[model samples]
Target: MPSTSISTGSAAGPAPCLAVSGASGKTGWRVVEEALGRGYRVKALLRPGSEVPEGLQGAELIRLELTDQAALERALEGTVALVIATGARPSVDLAGPLKVDALAIRQQCAACRAAGVKRVVLVSSLCSGRWFHPLNLFGLILVWKRVGERWLEASGLDWTVVRPGGLKETEDDLDAQGIRYSGPDQQESNSIPRRLVARVCLEALDAPASIGRIIEVTSAAGVEPLSLEQWLARQPQPA
Candidate 1:
């Protein structure tokens, strides 16, 4: 483990720093954007080959492989929290899910521990852990994602697993869409915009009740909008 620490702030004050992995991806960049918009200083972590997106312009970018323990730890050091938006992409490589969804999550958990980062939020899918799902055809992604979620749960850190339904790229009419959030595998079929997912990730960070919970989300025109805190308040504590 490396002893590197990110500078918090000097003259202004101590602004909490947030590290967002997979920052170049659609969801990752939005998470960074939302974090910055919420007044948190952000460190956007991307792969070396990942093309920098326009959304990451305001944040500090650190390019490194997640498998590089030293670099990962260095990126996470001094950051108050981390949002893991990394997921395996569809490709010819059959092992992509196992490597990215499972192994990489384990690696990130270890790095967070070594870096002294206490808070973590993972972006997973709605049907995660299901063996008979259609999405599992892509390298058993749902299964691997579940494995990753379990590892994070047992990581002994303040963690939240956000499993969203089918992701939509459209950012239009966001205000009209209300998010339906449930506990664990409640809602298996629906869709949500990536922007909404980004907002919930940040919301989970602010809500202490979200820690150690698996929040499943989806959106629609008629669903009533509610903050993560509001929804958490209505649910019974996990036994």
Candidate 2:
């Protein structure tokens, strides 16, 4: 059964800080912003040269390479959970996906274990792991994304993989856009605003039942609105 409670650290004090990797990215900054709005301290992690976007203004910024295990672990030391919003951008370098999507994830998982950050949420993509898809032309991105997901799944940490469809930049009238959630591969093509994707990443953190599951998301106007907990409640418990 899905736990109804949302953890705000221990009963004794302030909420544990949340660390969001790729904080300079479109979705990452939104996750950081949302976390802050929810009253949690946030650490926005970015690469050394990544620009500080306006969306990340209020959070503590830590700049470091994800491959630098020492630096990554240090940045995560005081954080209770890490939301991985990293993804390989389309670039001339064909190896970008392999490095950013796969190897970087392995490094983050290792860093999390070292830092004792037990909970993690990974923002992935729909059709991740599919080979024949057109998106694979770009460095076999989907394949590499699946590699990343598998790494987190086997890391022995409380983790949730949110695979959203083509991301949109528009944030207007978001309240009317209802998210359609499903198990892995159930959602193939559609689009959801990046803001909604950010919210679901945090929502997964609050829903204990989200652990060890891949939740695919897409949004449309007529779909019934449901929180992550509500959707999880309707599913059969894992045996």
Candidate 3:
């Protein structure tokens, strides 16, 4: 590996392959499409019974549950980096948050180490480490999400945690929205387009400064969408 460091918002080449889990979800599919549009190869990891979203057809698809160690390892093989877009879908089962958010994160980190995939970007949530928040009502989801973020932070892998505010489904006028980037525990209570969140995940893969850092993001109209590199240069690194 000749110099793994990269300026933010850029990947190595036209073929810098990325493996994306939860590729069946709306956000996951968009992440795959954006990666492809940017000229990077992508391996989409879906579940055994996951419906194949149309946009993901051209990319390499790997199907397996997160608990399947052999399949997980093989799917992540040959990828330089990974973006974890998996999240517990809204469910009546209260334990879904812990199982999918925290435990699954630990499993993926282990697989990354085994497969020699050193760079990872995690899609975390706002107020993750907080004890008193509404989302936590869902089986202490905020607490568990924090656990997941901590797992990646302590895993010793090159990692970045992107904590986005409330998610939205709107795509039109997205170009008019600018991502408000901040350090961990900074901004909260605003929403960002899922497409922008996907872009930030890919951007972190190519940003050396992004590693070992927690970046909070939310978007709003009337603000200039700044590049991650430009934002990073303006802030003092966490010490």
Candidate 4:
């Protein structure tokens, strides 16, 4: 199996309070849980009607619409960083992706800027920008996701976009899976457990080199498991 020491040094200081939007989703709640495990205080943000997931028990939960400028800003205030795990679910509504993935992301970026949250991590997907992919059949999700990513890139905050391949819910045997990390568009297909994706998001938060980069991830048993820092060291530095 791929062997590398993963460090939590990115968050070495007194852990900063973290804000996680979409805290009710499969991936979002895990981000909250992982952050709490890493000794960070967490604020979990959800839509007004979102159900409270059990994983959010220790977090401070705030319910509000992402479009509610005032509410979003208020929830983000005092948090040092924000992780946006929100994505439009598959639905009959044809415009859901435009509203949730693109528009909502723009709103969140504005709120982050207003709230002075300097660091933001966005959980996107692999093949996000392609128009011909099968995943785009649902409200053109991949297209909108790319739109959201572009907005974050221009948002003037420290940002990292983690684009993971098909997300699996399996938690067992995760320790045996080694993450294969690459830069944007490097990998088009594969799968990773949601749990691993969560850990990578937190790891990216602590790894300064992850800023302003789009990291693609997938995993399989026996693949080399390198920390985000180690993977980053192999890439050319940003100009």
Q: Highest TM-score, which number?
A: 2
C-alpha lDDT score of every prediction, in listed order? 0.91, 0.92, 0.86, 0.91
215 Cα displacement, candidate 3 (Å): 0.6
Worst 10 residues of 1 by lDDT: 1-10
lDDT by residue (1-239, candidate 2, tens digit) is: 33433466567787779999999999999999999988788999999999988999789999998888999999999898999999998999999999999999999999999999988999999999999999988999999999999999999988899999999999899999999999998989999999999999988888988988999999999999999889998998776
Residues 92-185 of candidate 3: C-alpha lDDT, one tens digit per residue:
9999989989999999999999998999888988888889988887888889999999999889889889999998989899989988998889
Q: What are the clash counts of all predictions, listed in order? A: 0, 0, 0, 2
Worst 10 residues of 3 by lDDT: 1-10
- Model 2 residue 232 lDDT score: 91
In candidate 4, what residue range of length 10 has the lowest lDDT sum? 1-10
Q: TM-score of every model?
A: 0.94, 0.96, 0.93, 0.94
Candidate 3 backbone collisions, by pair: none
Per-residue CA lDDT of model 1 for 1-239, tens digit only, reads 12222233345777789999989999999999998888889999999999998999889999999999999999999898999999998999989999999999999999999999988999999999999998988999999999999999999888899999999999999999999999888988989999999999998887777888899999999898898889988988776
* lDDT at residue 4 of model 1 (Cα atoms): 26
| Clashing residue pairs for model 2 | none
